[model samples]
Target: MLFDCIPSHEIPELLHCDWLQSCDDEATVLGLLDIFTSLALESSAPDNSRPGVLAALIKHARVLAEYVQRCGPDAVTTRSFIQWILAKTVAELRMEPGFHNVGLDRWDRLVINQGESVHLPVFVPLKPSEKPSWRMFLTTSNTTQESAVKVAYRAALHTDDLSLQAMALKLLSLQLEDPREPLRTLSLLQMGMQGDIDGFLSTSLSRYLLVEHLSDARSLVQELSDLDNLSGGQSLLYSGVNPCLLWARDVILGHLLAVISGQKRAGNREWERNSSLHRFEFQT
Candidate 1:
């Protein structure tokens, strides 16, 4: 295969090849994806090669997704491809040196700063004004983060694979942990409005409490209250007789109260346990 003839270190450059972009054969695309996946797992590759390989996989995954979507939505191949991208991204994040210590903020900044040097165009925005300085690459328009999250969210909603669902949740949780405004809040509200109330509440509340983001938590509570009122209390949580709005509201309010009471609580500890179980060691 042509991929076999290319050195692992130069795999990222293949994305720029005109022929590869023009190729429309699904078998060929899947074959290339499998080869890249295998290469990504080769630990013998120099540490310096990891970032480029990761970026290449992300870029190719986006290309493959667009191609797959043109064929049809929610196909088995689409789910499998999305799963592969998420799994590969998660694996790369795990292997990143000092990923745990540097924190997502620093790591995100590093990616943005080093993006140009590493030829990671995926991190760059199409329009400069679309992303202001305060926003992270993950929330930027048309970047790898947006594409990955969209596909993963779709896969999460459609796939019965428990592990894939977990991966999707983890990816969403990671994004939610970003301290940026508007985008973060918008993502949370979107999840809730889309009927993933459990995910919306658990991910946002747990992450906010874990980091002691009192203001954000309060804002979220207010947002939920307004949403419930706007829906005339017939929101997704409506349980035939009564809406679970009170239950959800109380759950968040209880966390806030616990934080306010000066009593050491278990939310952070529980979040830590769940995070560790998912192998995500991100520190706020």
Candidate 2:
């Protein structure tokens, strides 16, 4: 009840209390969520204070969702509350500055664990001609793809779940065609480095070549080769004469051959020729 006595602006600070953090009773948790929900829906609350209040509501809802899952008999109800809080928060704060920074880790975990059942509000594009994209609401700047890239990378690295990894990689691959150099290159590097290079990594390498990101493609192959050599040629990619390495070698060779035969136009004639020759030497 002490929360009721505090101003809405001060409610967020209550979440940091040591006593609240240690409280495990289900009633107390749910009661706190109820009080926060009321604060969130209070139209009379000052506009300047709303974001902080909603942020606390969201963070606590997420924490309670996890708590209920671990100490159950009420996880289902807790999850429903979390879903409501998330939807409400997005609806209210989608256009607010720094909106992307609040509770992203919590949202990521909820999506990973709950999947599509947790409905994330689609980002409203600034341009009328542009269509809305999921998770685009998290973009930090005019570069629309950055948030999705960061989310996919984090999700890929955070879990060993194969399906989730595949989903993250698939989302990452969608950004490979983005014209922004940094975004596309980040996607390529994340895809290759997140997991076993096996066939997946080769695909990323091939994409880099397709996109004409020659330097990055070459650097990745060299890193893989160096890693293999460092492992005394017993690394997973080299074990049993891995076909992936062979496939990658052939892909790079094919590219170099194309450049040498003038099948691909050289952007810098001398640099392309020298680079092609160096790659041929390394591959062979």
Residue 232 alpha-carbon offset, candidate 1, angstroms: 49
Per-residue accuracy of model 1 over 126-145 as CA lDDT, tens digit each? 21112122222121122465
- Give the Cα error of residue 69 in candidate 1, in Å: 3.0
For every model shown, what is its TM-score relative to the native structure? 0.35, 0.30
Candidate 2 C-alpha lDDT tens digits along 59-157: 655665566556665443342343333334333443356444344332211111111211112211111122222233232232344454344345444
Flag clash pairs in model 1.
none
For all candidates, the clash counts are 0, 0
Off by over 4 Å in 1: 1-6, 11-28, 34-49, 59-63, 74-77, 84-151, 178-284
* lDDT for each candidate structure: 0.44, 0.41
